[model samples]
Target: MKEIAIAGAGPMGLLLAIRLKQLGYENITLVDARAGTYTRPGILNASIFEELTQLIGLPVDFSDSYHLKDVERSLYKIAESLNIKIMKANFTGFEGKALRVEDEHHDIHILPCDLAIDATGSRRALVNEINRLFPDAFSVQPIADPSHKKHLMAYVKVEEKTDSDPPSTPAPYGFDFMVQKLEELRAMGWKGFVEPGFYALPLAKNKTCFYVEIPENLDASQHEKWLKTVVAFHTGKDNFDYTLLPASRKYGSKPRFLTFIVDPHQVNEAFFQHAQFPCVIPVGDAQIEPDYRIGIGIKSGAYRIKCLLDAMVLEKDQEFHIDFEKYQKELAAAMQMHAAALSKFYQEKQRSYEHYANLLSIYETVIASASMSKQKELQPSFAELIQAYAQSLYDAGNNALESILTSSGDIPLDKHGLIADEKKLEDAIARLIDAYKYAQGDLYTMASLKLNEIAHLYEKLADVFIQRGAYGSSLKCYEKANMIIEKILKDRAESVLIKYKHTQTLHKASRYEDMYDMACQTLSEIKNIGMDPEEKKKFTYKLELNKALALLHILHIRKDLEERDYYEDECNKAIKHVKSSPYLKDKHLLQLTKLLGEIPIESMCNILKDGDKSDLAADKSKRR
Candidate 1:
């Protein structure tokens, strides 16, 4: 039997010990400073619960999440019962066969170890020591872009003042049961609170653990200022106490405030290869840092344990050889791929949140202004309809944003994987469109709401689609939004702006004819209208230039002598307008004009072919 020592008796270490024993590996020891008494709370999904229950031959009760202490205590009993030695000691470091350890009494000792596995989450004690002492044993690399701005998450105990005494027992876990309990509290006049990007996990008595996600750029050094700024910005209220819990822990009986910087980094394969000690390997968070924001750590840890067993360990009574090279290659590739994908996931989530914030702010402002303003009695029904529409808009927008944000990325898998939440973004878009159709109001308010609010919503949706590489979807959204803008147009400038925006989308979607028609129609519509000379000149220059380019694209697809003549004329018109505007630079303009004066059929085809290749490359890049 191999003398194996697993450090850190967390879920990963305990599970690994049980599996190795079942595989007929004896003389295995599990060590941790906490000695199975854990306090930090962690989320447990269905996958982890099922795995633990099957491994131990006992039901591991399911819950939305659990405190690390509860999971450790339960797993500790199974580990001990299986004849796995459990030690109340800390893994200090290792030197070949000599493993340095510190007992609970703080006395140092060295234990013989043929192999060592580090399951210590995030602290990465053993891995760090090996790299520091040996200098060439391993490497640390950021899974996500290190240059990305790090966010903050603060987990604090929130104590609410209640007239009733504290409960004798702990809180329940079932979802339906918790819902019923919350309803009962609300029925008895208990008014709870809500804040953006925050959630509450119930604890014993009237206290709950509020996981407050601090937005970027907030000064976390000043606790009060950060909390107040977050609340006021989200709720438009300065009554800090009423909105958010007190920043100080003095008010709570169970005072707990733990803050962590949300930065995801990982160790390279050299850390696992153990060039110094080939028998040494790291597991769980020590291998790849978990994205705790979406609760992927525990579940991923379970997956990693099973994968490690499958790849390295064999059935009972078989050759007890480990394929170290095979596992290292698998893990390294997974880490690199997961890191690249996770970076994009966070970027998309940040954008979605920003879009959500804008929509929420607009919705709240509209509702607030409508409530305070005195409108004609005849318009009361219309005002109510508009308010109802705003509420629907907020609901659908939240659903769309949450669908992507709640998704968890799979780090252990060879390929990138993401599990989305309940509703798809397409569903939310459908619901919003349905609500908009019924939002009837007086002319001015309706037009303002449609143009400024609804149209902008579609534009934001288009931006998201563009980010997702759904060019056709983005083009449709932009075209529909431009139609909304046209319906509510109040001036010649508005007409010109709508056409410019629509033609831009058409150009991106490669609808050259539609782009040409839009520019032509807008030029005709604004021909007789009075406008500022400078503004008109700028719009005219862009519209004619785009119109000329659209015609060039059409001529590339097929020879068109008449259209080619029209294209040259349009280019001259663009030059004339651009020259009139002293603000417009003609440095690059001269180069573009020089190219457009050509009449070669072969050149246009080559340019068109190159454009197509670039667009395909862009599509591939966006998908990544």
Candidate 2:
């Protein structure tokens, strides 16, 4: 039998002791400052947790906030029945083959033990020691991200009038119940938790537990006020509208608050082993804190305990600590993967919130307008419809962005990760185009919403192709993107200026030649488009200057005289327009002309590829 001392008799610590006994370790001891096994207030999914508790021959009803005191009480009885030792003591540290322990009687003693495991929650002493003595083993923030300050959560009991329908696994991926709940809240004028942060469980016949995720930036004092507002609006406290089935917390009791981290996984540091002969380690949250939104903290922690014990059993019943290094490495890798997935999940929630809230607001406005009318329900305003359409377009664009990771196994470390997934990006562009087509036909898209969205989508798609070595496809994508922009901008002169904004975005992504052609075509089109003379001149000068700079860049790439002369021609055009037009005179254009004059272009074109030729002679021959 291996002698092991497990600290902090929380669920993980207690369960670990039980697991060791099953693995044939007889001299196992459980210790905590408080005299009990513990569980915090949380709604466990109960699938795996019950199995862990069952290992100790203890049973949980799985329908209530598990009380640590009661759990510890039960653990003590079980220990008594099995002849396993339970100690009420504060652990100081390890002193070789014994534990430096301070008992409840205020007496300090070094108790003989081979291994000391820390299962103390967030504020565990081992974490403090590691931070104080060996700083590199942990991050600046002990258990969670240093950036995430403790935030408040309120658990005001909503009075159970209709009664909850017993505890059961919620609908699998059951967003409908959540959607219905959100609709009810929206109708009742109470909205906080929804698609992203909202969660509820049918606990018993009396009350349903609701969680409100407050961001870390909020203040503590606002907890009561925020909860009160939820209660007041949910219950219709002012109007007594029982028909609304208004939700309210139990009357007379104030909504209380407790502090917890919103995103715990942001703390990346996993563990450090201080000794070798007799090993000690921190388990569960003391190692990796999970995002509470996933509801897997307890379950994940218990799983770790099982892994630790399993590793020990495989080591031929040697002290469990011997195999923990493997556990730590595996734990770190799993934590990393989980953190990435959680971040994606959180970001999706945030995006959905933004998109849905805008649409919800518009729907509410249309409803309000209808109610105030002396006639039938009014139609949504054109502005509201257009705004909703814009939001939809925005969502479609974001979906494309996400596919860069999802559809393709593209992650940051992979050479073909992020936006470099060409095939996936092409598929995303197709989806966006389909969405645009439907929106155009469905909502009578009267403006440039579909056009601009499709254009930008193709721009991104082009960049992806470039990364995948499909330069021809990239150029085609850019051409389509640029054509749509020009087609949309043709009706208004100011819109031409808007089209120029995309050039830099294209250039920023290394699409210089594409950007150059876009600028040149827009400038030429601006001349034919009906614009105020002064406005046309100003845009013309800007476009001409950009075209000259682009050709100069092209010459650098080709080292060909044809490209250099093209650069000079663009500069001369700007100069001629500045001198001839009465309304146009730009100092920048004259300066550019002077610079162009200084550049000595050789008399003949050389190194210009036959297929790359784009000149007035070629155009006039085609016209003839």
- Candidate achieving the largest TM-score: 2
Off by over 4 Å in 2: 37-40, 53-76, 92-99, 112-114, 139-160, 163-208, 215-222, 231-257, 266-271, 275-278, 291-293, 313-321, 328-341, 357-399, 402-478, 484-624
For candidate 1, the TM-score is 0.49
TM-score of structure candidate 2: 0.56
Q: What's the true lDDT of residue 95 in model 1?
A: 63
**Model 2: per-residue lDDT, tens digit, 465-546?**
6677666656666666766665554666655755565554455455668778878778767878897887877777667656
Q: What lDDT score goes with residue 255 in model 1?
A: 26
Question: For candidate 1, which ten residues in a row score worst on lDDT?
Answer: 409-418
lDDT measured at residue 529 in model 2 versus the true structure, 0 to 100: 80
State which candidate has the highest lDDT. Answer: 1
Q: What is the Cα-based lDDT of residue 391 in candidate 1?
A: 48
- Candidate 1 per-residue lDDT over residues 1-624, each given as its tens digit: 257888888888988898888777787888887766655544444466676787667765533455655677777777877889888899887766757889979998777776788888778878887778768566766777532333333443333354432222223333333333333323332222112244445545444554444434444465444543443333333332332334444334322454556677676653344445536678877877766555666666666666677666653654355766676666666666556666766654443333433433443444445434422321443344344455455456545544544234111111222223323544544444444454444433543443445456556666666677667877776776676666555354655765677787788888988988988887776776578877787777777767766766666665745656656556456545554646555453443433343433433323333444354445456657
